[model samples]
Target chain A: MSEVKSKIKRVSALKQRGKVLRDTNPLLAVFQWGCNHMMNEAELVSDQPLILDRDFKAFSKVQVHNQYYNEQELPNKFKVKEYCPVVFKSLRHRFGEDPADYLTSICDGQIYGGKSTGKGGGDIYYTHDHRLVIKTLAKEEVASFHHTFKQYYSYIVECDGDTLLARYLGMYRITVHEKETYMVVMNSIRPVGIPTHRLYDLKGSKVDRKASDKERAKDLPCLKDIDFEEAQERLYLGGDTETFKETLKRDVQFLEKHNLMDYSLLVAIHDCNEQTPGEIDRDVDVYHVGPHAKDLKADPKRLYFIGIIDVLTVYSTRKRAAHAAKTAKHGARAEISTVKPDQYAKRLLEFVSSMLA
Target chain B: MSEVKSKIKRVSALKQRGKVLRDTNPLLAVFQWGCNHMMNEAELVSDQPLILDRDFKAFSKVQVHNQYYNEQELPNKFKVKEYCPVVFKSLRHRFGEDPADYLTSICDGQIYGGKSTGKGGGDIYYTHDHRLVIKTLAKEEVASFHHTFKQYYSYIVECDGDTLLARYLGMYRITVHEKETYMVVMNSIRPVGIPTHRLYDLKGSKVDRKASDKERAKDLPCLKDIDFEEAQERLYLGGDTETFKETLKRDVQFLEKHNLMDYSLLVAIHDCNEQTPGEIDRDVDVYHVGPHAKDLKADPKRLYFIGIIDVLTVYSTRKRAAHAAKTAKHGARAEISTVKPDQYAKRLLEFVSSMLA
Candidate 1:
C-alpha cells in the first residue's frame, strides 16, 4: 500500500512539473494541450422544444439538451460588472467538461413568471449541437423550479421513515426590465390526473379508513370543502379571508399518523391585474429559503408551507396556508412564529386543525 | 411633434407587448426576432489579456488594460447561473433583439472575491469566440482574487484630474482555479496604470517641478523629509497608522491646491495586520475613501498604494457622526464635524509642511 501511494505521489509530482512548465509561458504548448482536452470533451447541448408532449420515455429524463442561436438572437448582452464574464467561468468550473451540456439536460429553457410551475431561470435556447444559450439574470424574474431526483438515484435512505428534499439541481434568477425582481427555479411533480380522493369535500367526513403504507407515505392533504376562487381573490387583492387551519390540521394529523415526509410550500403572485392559468404552487418548486421569507411574501401569489414533503400535501398546504397567512397577517405576525423544525411542524399541524374545526 | 409623440407611445406599447410574448414562450420566433435586433446593435468586446507589453494599444488610455490568458493554456472560465435561460428570455423582453450582444459590449468579464474567490462556483473556461465554459463551484476550497480595481481607480482619479471613475461599471461573479483551491468571482475594474502624481512621495525630492492646474492653484507644502516606506506600508495595509494619516493629509492638500477639488477622509481601523497585496482596499473606491495615493516607496516592484475615495469621507462622516450621536450617553454629540474638501486639502498640506519643518 505504501509503495502504491509512493507511485501515486510520483505521478502527481510529474504532473506538477508539467503544470509549472505550462505556467512558465502559458502561450506555450502546455496551455494549448489543456484547452484542447477541455474542448474535445465538451458537447454543446442542443435546444429542444419543451418536452410538452409528455413522452417521458423518449427523454433521457436526464440526458443533455442543446441550444443554438445566431449571434443576433442571444438573450443576454455582455455586462462588465454585475453581468461580468466570470459568471461563465464559474458555471464551467462547477459543471466541468460539458457544463453547458449537463445544464441543458436538466433545465427547461423558458422565461417563467407569474404563477409558474416553478421551473425557469431565463430565456434559454438550444443550439443545433445541443449547446445551451445562457442569459444574464437579476434576482426576481425567473420562475421557481421543481426537481425530482428519485427517478435518477437508486440507493435511497429513509430518515425517520419520511423522505426529504435532499439536494437542489440549480436555482433561477431573473432580470426584469420593468421592475427588478428575483425568484427561484423550482421543480414539483405534476399530477397526471385528479385523484379519486380529491373529488370529495373534506368538510364533514369522519369515516377514518385504516392507514396503508402507500396512503400514509403520500404527502397529500385530505381534500376538504374549499373555495379556491375566493382564496384566489383574497390572494390577488390583499384582504382578510377564512382560515383553512382546521382542514390543514386534520390532514397534517393524518400525515403524522402515517409517518409522512416534511416539506414546505411557496406561492408566487406575479401580477394583481393578470390572472395566470396555473396556481403559484403548480409553477414553483421546493426552494431552500435559508432566510428572506419576508421578501418572498412580497409576491401576492406566493405563499409557503413548511415540514410536509409529499407533493400533494405541499400543494394543498401552500394554497390553504397562503390564504391564511395573508389574512392572519392583519395580525399575521401574531400567529406564525419560526421555531425549531420539529416544533414548527407540531404548531403547523395544530394551526391547520384549528382552521378546520 | 405631436405625431412623433403619439408614435413613440404606440411603439412603447408594442414593445411592452412584444416583451411579454417572448417571455411567455422564449422558444418562439418572437424571442428570436428580439434577440436579433439586440445582437445586431450590440457591441463586441474581447477577453483580451489583462497586461500589455508597454506599447500595446487595443484599449484607450482611459480604458482598462486586461491580460488575456495565453491560448496555449486554459483561458479564464466564467460561470453563469443555470437559470440564465429564463433570464435570457427576460432580457429579450426588455432589451429586444440582440440583447445579449448589447450587454456583451459593456461587460468587463472579470470576477472578484476576497475570502472565497475560487471555490464553490466551480471552474470556468473561455473559447476564442468569447463563449463561456460554465461549471459549478463549491462553497469550500476556493481561491482568492488578485486583481486590484478600487486601488487602481482611486489612484487614477487622485493623480490625474480625471473623473472617469464616475462612469461606473458593474461587477461580475466568477470562479478561478489555481492549483487545488477554487474561488467565487466578484468584481473587476478597467485596468490602467496609475498616474505619476498619485504615485508621488510626500517627502521625496523628485517632485513634479512643473505643477499642473490643481497643484498650482493651491498653497503647496514643501516637505523636506518624508518616510516613503512608511507611506507605502500604510497604503498597502490600511489603518489609521500615524504615517498613513499623515500621507492622507498631505495628499488631500495636494489635490485641493492643484485640482480645486473638495473631499474628506474616513479611516477605519481594527488593529492593522501585515499587508496583503490586493486586499487592502476591497470596498474602498475613489468616491468612498477619496482617490488612491500611489506607492512611491524606493522598492518600485511593489504596486501597493493608499486607496481612498472622497464620497466615503462625506457620506461616512455624516453616517458615523449620526451613529456616534445616537450612542452618546453624555450630552448630545457635538455638531457632526467633517473635513470639507478644501479644508481637507489644506489640512493635508499643513501636515506635510509640519513634517518637513
Candidate 2:
C-alpha cells in the first residue's frame, strides 16, 4: 500500500556474494558463521564488567540474511542464538582464550562427528584441533540449561572459573531447514595424541549403572559406574588431594544447591610407563593434577584426567516427576539419575573421594 | 581449581586486535560488528527455504567476551540480538537488499545521526549516504513490534512489499552500561538534496493535536494535525488518485485487522521550483515513483515525501484501557490517538482521501 513503490532496485545491483566455508553441512556452516559473528561481536564488547546473575538469563541473538558467507552450501536464511553471553564471555576470558583465535578455531575448522562408537544416540562433534567439543542438547536439556543458567553462571564466577565442572565455553541454538538444534561447546575431555587406556562416567550409583554388553563390544566404550566399581580403580590424585577435594567439594555443593542431578566425574587414566608424563601437553588438559612434571617426585606409574561432566540436568517439576516414576519402578532405594540433589551430591562426593586414595 | 593453570598464556600471545570502524561510539561499533557478523553468517545459510509461521518466533543470539574490539570505549561486554531473522532476511530480499551490501552500508560506512533540526526527543541516525534511518524504540514499542511481527511479515509477503507502511528492514537490541537500547532500521523518508520546505504529521485527530509554541520555536518544527487542518492544504496527489486510494484502503485494512492505532502519515513537501527535480539523485530516494527525467509530464512544481511512521502500537489491554479512559475524559466523540482500531482506521482513511480531493 506504500505509494512510493520502491523502484530504486539496489538489492541485485551489488552481485558480490561471499563464499561459504568449504565442505560442510548447512547446520555446521550456519553454526560456524554464528560462532565467528559472536566472537567478533564479543571482541568489541568484552571490556565490560563481569557478568551478573541477570545477565546469565539473557541472550545475544543474530539473524542472517541472504548475503551470508556461504550461499552455495548454506541456507539463504537461518537463526542462531547464544544464551548467557556475559557469563560465557567472562568464562572464556578466565580460561585465557583469545576471542579472535576462538573465532578462527570454530569458523575455519571442520566439524565432523567425534567418532562415537555408537553407544550414544546424541550427536557430538569435535573441533578440528580437538580442543572444543560441540554436543547436541535435547529439548528438555536445553530447557534445563535455561532453568539453571543463572545459578550455573553464578557458581562459575564465584569459583573464578576454577571448579572441576566441565568448562562450558558457549551455548547456542541454530535453526536450519526448519529444525532447531541446541548445542553447548565445552573444553574437550578427550585429549589428543594420548591413548587413555580406560574412561569412566562415574555417577557412583551401582544399580543398573554398568555399560551394557553391547556398549562394551565397541572400541573405546565409555565405561560406567558398575564397571568402574568392578575394576577397583583408585584415583591416582598424585598426593595433591587437599586442594582437589576442596574444589570438588565446592563444585558438588553448587550442583546440590541448584538441585542438579545425574552429573558425572569423567575419569581418564593414562599409563605413565607406557607414555611418560615428561612432556605433558598442559593445553590439552584443564583438569590434570600432579606435582608438575618438572617436580622431583613426579610419578611415572599413572596420569589422571578428571573433570565433572553433565551438569546441565536440574531438578525441576518435570525432573521431580521423573524421580517419582523411577522410585516407583525401581523401588525407593534405586540408584537413578533423578535422585534428589542432596542425596545425589552426597553419594557422588563419597564415591569420588573414596577412590582418590 | 583447574589443575592445568594454563601455562600456555595466549592473551598476550595475540596482541593484534582487529581495527574498529573509525569514528564511532562503542554501541555503534558493536552494532557494526554484529551487522558484519550476521551478513557473513547469512551468506552460508541463505539457501534455506522461506520462513514459516513458526520461524517468526525464532531468533539468533551471540555473546562476546573480553576480546571485543574497541574495548576502551565499548562496554567490557554487552549483548546484541536480532529477532525473527528468517522472516526479516527473506523480507529484505523481497525489498531488493543484497545482504552483503546492506552489511557494508551499515558497518563499513560512517554512521552519524541523521541531521535532525532537533525537534524530537528520540535519537535518529542515518547511514553515511543517508540511505537508512535507525531510530530508537521504547520498551513497549519493542514489545509491540514483536506482537505485530508475524502479521506484518505475512502482509508484506502477501503484498509483495507493496504498502504505504515503512519498509521495516531490521530490529536489534544492544545492552551497554547496564542499559538496553532497542532500535529499528527503516528506509528514510527524507529525499536527498530535495529540500522538504514543510513537513506535517497528519493523524486526522482533532483532540488537541497541535504542535506547542515551544515546538513551533524550533528551526524546522514538525507541524501536527491541528496545524495541518488550519493550513487547509489539500494533498497534491497529482492525477494518480485511484491507485493511491486503493493502496490506502488496503493499508487501512491491515492496520484495522491488526488492531493498530496512533500511526501517522509523515509528509515532506519538497519545493521543486526552488531547485529543479531534474538533477534528482534517485539513489538518495529508495522510493521514488516517477519515470526518469525524460518524461514530459514530470512536474517540477513539487516532490512529496510520504511514509507511515509509528506503526508499532497495538491495541493491547493497556491500549484498550487507555481508550476507555480517554472516552470518559474527552467524551466518545472527541478524537485521540487511543481510538479503537475500527473507528481509527475509518477516520484515518476518511481524512487522507478528503485531503487528496
What TM-score between 0 and 1 does chain B of candidate 1 receive? 0.24
Q: List TM-scores for all candidates, in order.
A: 0.21, 0.51
For residues B181-300, could you state the per-residue lDDT of candidate 2 as single tens digits?
777887766654456677788787888678889768865568888898788866666665666778778987998898888788887776656665456654444245321111111234
Best by lDDT: 2
Report the C-alpha lDDT of model 1 over A19-136, residue by residue, as the tens digit: 1111121111111222222222121111233322122111110011112211112122211111111222222333232433333222212211122111222332221222222222
After superposition, the stretches of candidate 1 with alpha carbons farther than 4 Å from their true spots are A1-73, A76-357, B1-349
Candidate 2 segments whose C-alpha is farther than 4 A from its true place: A1-24, A67-70, A114-122, A276-299, B1-357
DockQ of candidate model 2: 0.04
Candidate 1 has a TM-score of 0.21
Q: lDDT per residue, candidate 1, B16-75, as tens digits?
A: 111111112111111122222222211221112222222111111000111231111212
Best by DockQ: 2
DockQ of 1: 0.01
